[model samples]
Target: MTGKIRGISILALLSALAAPPALAQSAAPSTAQPAAPQAADASQLEEIIVTAQRRQQNLQDVPLAVSSLGASDLQDRQIRDTIDLIQHIPNLIGNNNVGLGSSNTYYIRGIGNTESIATQDVPVGTYVDDVYISRQNANNFGLFDVERIEVLRGPQGTLFGRNTTGGAINVIMKKPSATAGGYLEAGAGRFGETDIRASMDAPLSDKVLTKVSMYRNRSDGYVRQVNTGDKLNGSDNYGVRGAVRLLPTDRVTIDLAGDYVDENEANLINRVDPATGDRIATIGITQGALAKYFTGTKANNEVGNSTKSWSLSSNAAWELDDLTLNSITGYRQTTQRYFIDSNPAAPNPIATGVSPILNYSLHQQWSQEFKANGQALDNRLNYTVGFYYLHENNWTDLGTGVGTASGFTVSGDRTIKNTLDSYAHYAQGDYK
Candidate 1:
């Protein structure tokens, strides 16, 4: 059993090092075994491995511009979510667009998707364990128990297909291992923040291994309501993940994993007037008399969000003499319900029978991919060929109507529903 708490702040750091060359020494020619090399120090850079080409390879040999962060590197940098990567990744800009509690808008090289509609396509694609994430609002995953994150720049259309016009962000999770070990971590910071994280790995049999992890966090809002003293823009969330690995034979391996996330957090809009650099009032509230403009509000504070998401995936691989066969299958679903203050400069929602703007969305997607990687021509040529299929269903509703103390009695609503199916066949080969 696992438990979680949500909403905390994170900080990060980056460092660089320069190493001087070692002096050469003259030695007499001898047929004796060479002396063992000295132990490497901090100046020696560690070798980095990546799967940017759908196959594990040295980072320096991928023949593409890619950045990677390992688990230890992420912990050292205090990276908590996708948004935190902006500071560390080059030519990247990311943020949570107003109103969505757990969604992300990302731009790479001046290309991105701002609209959350179902028909729109994200120029930058996001993936986990080779499974494609089809929605923008569904890609802002909280980082925990991550093995590594790889950011590939420039167009990757030939391999990644559509939505790769900008680039791709691939997140790899830590898998179940034969070792039985785990860890627990707790932390606290300003704004009444607290967090707890725990994980455990257990082996069920000689060939079966399982791992589970959970996290919870909570924090007070950065913005406050002057009259009610209520916090806005705070977080309350928890999540859990489980993975199982099976090795039925020496040449075959299978992995199955699942995860779920829940968030109940406050959302507030804080806009500034660029001309005067003062906070703008909403719903006929005074211009600046209630409280300081920076972090104070006087509007009705009945806005918040509820989000839930879950996913399941399976991966299998079979090794052959000169080739490898792989299959990846995944399914995901998300539901988000949120409301926002719509009355700009009218009789406050309290006086008028006006309701807040209500927004809701439900999304589902699944994908299947089968591929083979092999070398030919005396091991001088390497190739990958694959077939892919994707299915998606999405629903969205936006409405406004009469307001009540408990909730809005929506009288008007606009609903949209869409379904899509896609298929592709691709092949790539490299010769030396």
Candidate 2:
């Protein structure tokens, strides 16, 4: 595999480790039981705010359909990644094809792209901290210190720049708080699983604050490999994030954050089928005895995978008497690699041997956005306008090895390149 393809494949594998469960703080009430009539006051109601249109507004007041999941809600559901979050969001579905590594496809409102090619962009747009993610392979970035996740349904052609035909997901990470505090959590579960997470926030100075966070997860495989007596479908991952906040003045603020993640694991499992509807007690065949029937001498194939990634982002805001200016910038790079059996001995070809496919891919992306919003016509109406830019590059390598009884092998290589750029201005108004 080429260097670029190898890099992307590694990134894909690493992303799986970062997948954090979706936690929504507002999905349920603080108390387990219903409250008394007298307690049902305005103060008792849960308030949900969203920025689907690049401006903060009450979620109920927005015309578009959207689902807002808060920290508490996410925690309650035990959600730890986009795949799990999709289950809670109506009209959305996602699934990972086993043995395909992290190549997952998402469908929104019954529309989505299933092809796993690096050159093809997802019909839906995914954003973290208001920064657009151009490549679908990068969607596995874990959720850490995330304050909220907004899944906007329907086409968002006006505000979001590209690939918004289906919808958009907005991941808002927690900002550095002025308060000094931290939290650590660890958990162990069935299947030789363990997880560790740590986070801390401290005031660097009177006007500056810093935050750091990290997590690690590991699990034993659930599937057993008969050939090597090894288990398949296990994973390990680690990642860190750092942030610095600058409050130069009361009306102006700047925040800079960066994160990195690494992961390695054996992914996917395959088995031989006797073809007959009824089960059979091990087809009577020996390794060397079946060598002639097998075009490839290889008896069994395995799936191995790995990935790594790094990202940087900045969110700055300046406030004036009647207007606020906001700018967001972000950059990310990732790599992924994996091996799978292209052809398995099944009902059609029981005597034929298995052929393994080796594939690798890489991806790098950068994006920037600027927006200005203010009240107009004596505060009776609010307005917003913005500009956006994004760039992405990727590479991939795919080849298959056919093992013959004679121990013969052959392989080939394929390459791909892609680029996208866009600019737009938008304006919105609301009457209160």
Tens digits of per-residue lDDT for model 2 on 1-432? 699999999999877756543233435456666645664567665779988888888888789989999878887887666667778999888775334444456788887887566677787788888888776554655566778899888988777755888888888878888999999988998779898888999988879999998888888766554434455566777789999999999999999999988866544535443453322211122234322332332322224566677899998999999999999999988876665545544333224444555556678888888899899788998888888777777776655555533453655444556665656667677787
Q: What is the C-alpha lDDT of each candidate?
A: 0.76, 0.70
User: What TM-score, computed on C-alpha atoms, does each candidate reach?
Assistant: 0.80, 0.78
Of the candidates shown, which would achieve the greatest TM-score relative to the real structure? 1
lDDT of 1 at 123: 85
Clashes of each: 7, 41
What stretches of model 2 exceed 4 Å from their correct place? 1-44, 97-103, 265-302, 342-356, 400-412
Give candidate 1's whole-model lDDT: 0.76
Candidate 1's residue-wise lDDT over 1-432, tens digit each? 122222111111111112122212324456877879878797966889998888878897889999999999899999887778888999988776455667777888888887666779888889998999888765666788899999998888777878888899999999987989999999999888888888899989979999999989888766543334456667888899999999999999999999998976644454454565633323222222211211212222235666788999999999998899999999999887665555544333334433355567889999999989999999999899899999999997765555444343545567779999999998988999
Error of 2 at 276 (Å): 18
Deviation in angstroms for 57 in model 1?
A: 1.0
Off by over 4 Å in 1: 1-37, 40-44, 226-228, 271-302, 341-357, 400-412
